[model samples]
Target: MQPFMNSPENYHILESLDSLVQSISENQKEFFQKVSEIRDNHYTLVKSYYEESRRLIEMLKETAFLCSLMFNIQDEKSICASAINILRKLLENPVAIRILSTSNSHTKLEILAEESSAAFSIKSLCTKSPLSCIAIKTCRPIIHSPLESAVPCPEMMESPEQYAHICFPLIADGVAFGCINILFEHDTDIMLLKRNIDLINILAGYVSLAIHNNRLIKTVKKEALTDKLTGLPNRRFGMEALQNEINRSKRYGHVFSIAMVDIDHFKLVNDNHGHTEGDKVLTLMADLARKCLRNVDLVARFGGEEFLIILPETDIDKACVVVERFCRIFNEASLSDVLNAKNLTLSGGIAQFPHDGGDVLSLLKAADERLYLAKNSGRNRIVAGKLN
Candidate 1:
């Protein structure tokens, strides 16, 4: 049997066994290659998912920050400032915010806030040709590189050639109210901006809503404190302002003055002329008073045909001078334009702080008493002191 195994006929069987072993070895090698390839593919998929998830998480945090801005900030400038800060952090680039307001069919761009890490001054890009801003004209997001276009935006010509620029129009209720301008320092930064477009858009939306809410709040507050007919501060605001002035005077030992003003024969104007004309008279008086008084003075409509003026850092003589000047201007105004009557005159009584009284009630009472004396003695002159 051992001799037969070594013979030429038996050698063919050994060759067949060897061939089978070689075929199995090749199949095992191919199988291992497929398994290794599949493992590599799985690892790539997991890494992609992880990166996407991390990006989403960061976006959520950023969105939450913008949402907080809506509730916390009330001033428009402050809101823009906060938005610019957060945007600079998220984009890792310089940022500027501008608001466009439409008035009389003309658009104006105001640069509200800016944040930059670079050592260059960032100014309003649309100062010369606001209408030429393509982003505002199209109401779309604009990604611009000076090197890529033949004719760049007119406003963008002054920007550095090394930096890329982006503009995101802030639209609310289908109207573009403002834009967020970003400066990309490098090509990689531009790529980053492209990848994070959706996130930046969401940020723009939040900022738009914040500005809208702030304007609404300011309008409501103005309407509440303002007199509708004369466009002056109403009685409630007047009293609050008086109290505030009193507090300031007491704290700083500063001398101030208050005056009670009355429109002379205002009822006769209403009775002779129509109430519409009377409204014009009130408006005229308000305009004249505002024009004559300094910016630090407060002229409020205390009641019908009555005004309370608070003059800060003014004594009795200066207060009297202010009222006398206002009276001159008020009397010289053309009343015949709106009404068939003579010129109007104003009677005012002035009182100094610490000389009259310390509190709002006492000061008001003293001024009112002097005003009554002015009305009884004659109706055209201002009285600064009580009768002896």
Candidate 2:
């Protein structure tokens, strides 16, 4: 019984099973190949999406940096510089070449910043530039072909032969502060400019806010340092100025002088007359001191009836001469008619750098001591020199 080994039925069954196994193996291989192709395609798509997202994020970061540059700065000139820098960055496009700027309520448009091969005479933009005028008037952004339009700006006329122009208004709170003009080659993709329109608008808003905030800060700072009644620097500002002078003198090894001045019989005047007259006297003293001192000198109201004057590059002797000259003029002046008093006089004490004292506190103390000495010795005299 070599048995059924040679049976045709068994052989046929074995052949059928072999065929089925081969078929299953081929189908499995094809399924794995299809899965691999799908995986590759998915990876490619993910990579593309990630790269695009990264690029967009970088652009947004750049925009944020530009806005920060505009907002963080507090000076008009610095703001202008920032705006120019942004223009330079935006102009990095091969198509963009020039920029112009103008302010609201201004008749002339100026070439703020530009980068081009040709010399541009576009110094001013006339009202005839319909694009810029419309943008400013509407407080909006406009895109147009400058070459075809009636853009009477000399700069635009001189601009590259074929170009597109974009004008954006810097507006905040319903007020247009300024406008920015940009130039691009005619062949530049309009879609690209359209894509950046929102970003440009955001930058304009930041610029407007920066200018407004800078002005407000300047006004506040001036008010902080100034005396309301005398129109002189207040004590706080005087102290800061004195410290600065000290630092400067130390650095340059130069001599400077400071004086503490007091009005003679100020209390008596305040008592006899009303406070209104007292205020007037103070104001007059400030004006007189301002007139007497050189432009390099600084005068500040230290306290009631007391003023501090900082004289740069002056010695004790020169300070004494200056104070004496001022006193003589003040005493001889027709102040009686204004004050309802026969005479109005001033007393001052001088302190020189490194001679009287080295630091602000020491110098102020020394000057104040001499001022007391002058008051004790005589009401209307100046005391200067090293302490005895």
Q: What TM-score does model 2 achieve against the real structure? A: 0.71
* True-structure RMSD for candidate 2: 9.5
Q: What's the lDDT for all of these models? A: 0.80, 0.76
lDDT of 2 at 384: 93
> Which has the greatest lDDT?
1
Clashes (candidate 1): 0
Where does model 1 exceed 4 Å of error? 1-24, 94-106, 128-131, 145-158, 334-339
Collision pairs in model 2? 122-155
Name the runs in model 2 displaced over 4 angstroms. Answer: 1-57, 92-118, 126-136, 147-165, 172-174, 183-192, 329-342
Query: lDDT per residue, candidate 2, 239-312, as tens digits?
Result: 99999999999999999999998989888887898788889888877888889778999999999999999999
Question: lDDT per residue, candidate 1, 1-388, as tens digits?
Answer: 5796788878998999899999999999999999999999999999998988897787769676766756588887788877776676666645444444443344566676666655666764555444777777788788876556645566777876777778888877887866787776535356657777777777788888888878888899999999998899999999999999999989999999999999899998889987887888889889887888899999999999999999999999999999889988888884556545578888888888989989999899888888888999889989997656
